[model samples]
Target: MATASVVVPAREEAARLERTLASLGRQSFDGRLEVIVVASGAATLRIAREHGVVDRVLTDDRRDGPGAARNRGAAVATGDVLLFTDADTIVPSTWVRRHWRHYATPAVVGVGGPLRPLADGLSHRVRFRLLSDWWYRISWSVGFVQQPGPNCSVRRSAFEAVDGFDESLPFLEDTDLSLRLREAGRVAYDPDCPVRTSVRRHEREGYLPLLLAYLVGYLEYALPGRSPTREHFS
Candidate 1:
């Protein structure tokens, strides 16, 4: 069995981090799977230790961004495969295995899964579903496959070859990494490895504004000679 290092990037989310940790604790993967939580503060470290699900805890005082935090964590991960997910996601028990199964093909360097909304509200669910489909379409139309950032895994070598996540971008780091990873090898999407991520971003920012922001970002990426959008999305 192959080993994997699960990297979670968080910022002041100690209160909600436990739920994600608990979900990870329930994974049935029997191989060497280690959880590394990269937190931007001391508070998150304390929370990660309390949950006791993480094998390693890293602290980044810079508080640069999720991409920086994840890069820092990936630097010290002990596994050949690095799994990246948000602290706000609840991964299914078979999440690791689903990603692991694809490694049987030597040409496969990365795998991305779907993001399902955990919110019970009908409107929230509908919004999340639409956004999910939009992301899938964006990945296809862009000509570079991108899996959901909150639930994706890549071989460490390929990640390093592509220079890892682009920390310079405040948003769309996943898309940047996906495009670069595609250059190294085949990047795949497996629907069975879906993770449940919080829909609070849409809930807080309003769906229309969030959608518009994403469209603008995609446009910037699609246009030639145009600079990438530097706007940050929370």
Candidate 2:
């Protein structure tokens, strides 16, 4: 019976934080669950408390990047398992349970699930979900399984073994973590444990460009400096 800590790194995401916490509150896990929200603003802290779901909240006034914020939360986490998700992600009722069940096998060091890109319109939802689901399925089936940061979990020991996420990476940090996790032990991908994530990146930057940027980031992660493109959080 391993306890779990859910860390959500937020940067001025008060609006979405409410929904994210709401979803977490609905989770069906019976284990000792600890939820921490590492946010940068007073508003975020207020919203987090308003939701009345999180077990703990860390106020980082520096507004550090996702990796930094998450690392800060991980440092204080007191659990055998560490689960990471974004402030904009709406996890299913079985999200925590699904990830925890994977740890039943000793060889499983980390577990990653698929992303369900959310949209308002019916057409938009269908289009984004189909493409994203297909892409993740193919990527996971191929061996270089990349976990969406908003829907991934790792054993505390294994996470400490890889030294956790690299705080310097502005983007594609999850992919880098995945590579190191694979070296330690098996990293399982469960399509059934999908999480609903915002498509705001594509909505703000255009779908094609966002997709191209992710592909470029993946290449850079796979091939290092040889890749023609560089990652940018902006």
Residue 102's lDDT in candidate 1: 86
- Report the alpha-carbon TM-score of model 2 versus the true structure: 0.90
Instruction: Report how far residue 133 has shifted in candidate 1, in Å.
Output: 3.9
Query: Against the hidden true structure, what lDDT does model 2 obtain?
Result: 0.82
Off by over 4 Å in 2: 223-234
Question: What do the candidate models score in CA lDDT, each in turn?
Answer: 0.82, 0.82
Residue 169 CA displacement from its true place in model 1, Å: 0.9
54-160: candidate 2 lDDT, tens digit per residue = 88888987765888888888999998889999999999999999999999999998998877776677755776666556676776676565677899998899999
Residue 71, candidate 1: C-alpha displacement in angstroms: 0.4
Model 1 is weakest, by summed lDDT over 10 consecutive residues, at 225-234
Question: What is the C-alpha lDDT profile of model 1 across 1-234, one tens digit per residue?
Answer: 568899999899876788898988988887988999988666778988777678988877889998899999999998878999898889999988889888778898899887888788888767766677556756555555766689889988999998898888787788778877877888887855678998889779998999899789767766665434222110
Each prediction's TM-score versus the true structure: 0.91, 0.90
Candidate 1 matches the true fold with a TM-score of 0.91
* Best candidate (score: TM-score): 1
Model 2, position 81, has a per-residue lDDT of 88
Clashes of each: 0, 0
